[model samples]
Target: MESIYDEIEIEDFTFDPVLQIFQYPCPCGDRFAIALDDLKDGEDIAVCPSCSLMVKVIFEPEDLEEYT
Candidate 1:
């Protein structure tokens, strides 16, 4: 399992339509990415592609309707 540093508000992340992923900037110069399908399945954590950091996304289920 990965270590979750803290919870990040959903408003902090941005969506990419082409990639269909939600991303937030990481201190490592990489980004934390969580797929739409994963979020729909009740997965809240997103990890950076370059590092071992992860954060739990704070959002309600209904928050995903706009993306789905």
Candidate 2:
């Protein structure tokens, strides 16, 4: 039951330039979010603030260069 909701590519997430965070749609009608810093640190999980659902972000470190 603790497993992730899904595996989503980082490219599928919307990046907020100002907030420097990536977000994806959550089934709870909210969004799952992960900080750019967290991704840079090799963290791959994005969590929904409105629920317990989470997703594993699939991306390579080099893929984040453009966003930086």
Candidate 3:
């Protein structure tokens, strides 16, 4: 099975603090934007608006540098 990162094609990613979200374009033709609160404890379930796909993301404190 392909990983979520592989499915999303997230490279050189960045975050938006004003929105409290992480924005990245996905390979599946959707822009995957996740809220900071959603990613608490390194795991979150998010819905993709373009593809109507559900995604599970695992995060770490290091991954949230911008939000902090």
Candidate 4:
């Protein structure tokens, strides 16, 4: 079965007004979630901090999905 991550296309990082959060998939196969209130523009990448992995928070429209 396909995963949710493979069902939808993910676009570049954009501020989600409704959720007020920034969401993106990291290169480490993990999802990186950041609060919009805690982020600043021009910040596209961040360290996982927890796992110490380099994570990119931005992606093209074809990079996201809703896997099950």
Can you give the TM-score per candidate against the true fold?
0.92, 0.96, 0.54, 0.36
lDDT of 2 by residue, 1-68 (tens): 56799999999999999999999999989999999999999999999999989999999999999999
> lDDT ranking from best to worst?
2, 1, 3, 4
Off by over 4 Å in 2: none
Per-residue C-alpha lDDT of model 1 across residues 1-68, encoded as one tens digit per residue = 67897799888899998888999999999999999889999999999989889999999988888886
Q: Considering every candidate listed, which one attains the maximal TM-score?
A: 2
Residue pairs with colliding backbones in model 4 are 3-67, 4-66, 4-67, 4-68, 5-67, 8-64, 8-65, 8-66, 10-64
Look at candidate 1 and tell me the lDDT of residue 44: 97
TM-score of 4: 0.36
Collision count for each candidate, in order: 0, 0, 0, 9
Worst 10 residues of 3 by lDDT: 2-11
Q: Write the per-residue lDDT of candidate 3 for residues 1-68, one digit (tens) a residue.
A: 43344333223345776887766665688767778776755545555567755555555566666566
- State residue 51's C-alpha deviation in candidate 2, in Å: 0.4
What Cα-based lDDT does every candidate model obtain?
0.91, 0.96, 0.59, 0.45
Q: List the residue pairs that clash in candidate 1.
A: none
State each model's C-alpha RMSD to the native.
Answer: 1.0, 1.2, 4.1, 10.6
Say which candidate scores most in lDDT. Answer: 2
How far residue 11's Cα lies from its native spot in candidate 4, in Å, is 6.3
